[model samples]
Target: MRITTKGQVTIPEEIREAAGFGPGTEVDFVIGDDGLVRVIPSDRLRGERAASLQGAISRLRGSADVALPTDEIMALTRE
Candidate 1:
């Protein structure tokens, strides 16, 4: 498969299905000393398994909240 002018290449359907990759799924790339590239599920990239939203919220319960100005929040949202 060739990369388009935008430097985008379409992942083949068979590969995507086999890897369980779908819309919104994330992946990571690793380069070995031997110059081999490996594609890994994003969850394994940071040595973290995906957690539910509830778990994430629970983990943040004790974190201090920093209030941001409305304009800053809006700018961040746009990004």
Candidate 2:
């Protein structure tokens, strides 16, 4: 696909879906030792960071491990 004057080329819908590139996904382009350019999704790293810090977050909530039903979890998020 052609890149616009803004240097933005549209990533295909299939590629986007496969890479989980939803709105506001941060990405980086890196050149590997093999001289191949790779696209890395930084947003996923953010998620990884959050997951790694889950224990700290839980601690803030008094380390409660109450298991809520899936529906209840969904309901709270929906609100």
Q: How high is each candidate's TM-score?
A: 0.51, 0.49
Point to the candidate with the largest TM-score: 1
C-alpha lDDT of residue 66 in model 1: 83
lDDT of 1 by residue, 29-65 (tens): 7898999977778887655544565679899897858
Angstrom error of the Cα, residue 23, model 2: value is: 0.9
Candidate 2 at residue 33, lDDT? 100
> In angstroms, what RMSD does candidate 1 have relative to the true structure?
9.7
Best by lDDT: 2
Q: What is candidate 2's lDDT per residue for 1-79, written digit by digit as tens?
A: 9989999988999999998888888898768899997777986667767987996777788554888899998999999
Local accuracy by lDDT, each model: 0.82, 0.84
lDDT of 1 at 76: 89
Cα RMSD (angstroms) for every candidate in the order listed? 9.7, 11.6
